[model samples]
Target: MMRTPAPRLRTYLSGYVLSLVLTVAAYLLVTHPSYSTSLIVGLISALAVVQFLVQLVFFLHISAERKPRWKLMVFIFMVGIVLIIVVGSIWIMNNLNYRMTPQQINTYLNNQGGGF
Candidate 1:
């Protein structure tokens, strides 16, 4: 039987440091907003994903071990959930952006000779 090595202090420290850096980056992106909205959104999303992986691998020990298939399935399910959430959010925001405001709605109502 092969003995698996346990996680060391350095691994945890690295993950912690990376998470801090990513958090700081997200804060800076929100505070500065120097880049385009789309660009900023993409960067923040990417950073969040990287941090998630880092925490999973380093802290949660999501690596090759017993029940590898189970781990893979869980990871797949999590990815699917994240995809659904991100896609749904983007879709909703896109639709809201294209929707007419109250002013436009009033103008339309006046033109159509309808008010309620």
Candidate 2:
């Protein structure tokens, strides 16, 4: 009986190492910047997306042969939806809080005062 050769372990190891490096780099970018919060946040977000793609293609081996493509696709779609929802909620809430009319502000403050 012929034995099949084992898959290359080094490839997987390298991919893991790359992913770790990217994660650390992203973290550093987010934490080290003291003034440019917006720039840091954008860089971190971009890095996260790149790291996720790397993990999916290299670590997870998400390919046609996997046959569970739909599962991965669905997960990605759900993540996208959640991200949009969260970001949109934050933006809308911020706008509403800061841009409210005097009447709206008075009503909100009154409600809070009543609770207190």
lDDT of each: 0.85, 0.75
Residues 2-75, candidate 1, lDDT per residue (tens digit)?
A: 33357789989998999999999999998999999999999999999899988987787777345546776888
Distance from true location, Cα of 85 in model 2, Å: 2.3
Give the Å error, residue 70, model 2. Answer: 1.9
* Best candidate, lDDT: 1
Q: What would you estimate as the lDDT of candidate 2?
A: 0.75
Task: Give residue 94's error in model 1 in angstroms.
Answer: 5.5
Q: Which ten residues in a row have the lowest lDDT in candidate 1?
A: 63-72
Q: Which clashing pairs does model 1 show?
A: none
| Candidate 2 C-alpha error for residue 94, in Å | 1.7
| Candidate 2 residue lDDT tens string, 1-116 | 21323436775787789889989998788668765888888888888888888777666655422453576788779999998999999999999879987787778888888422
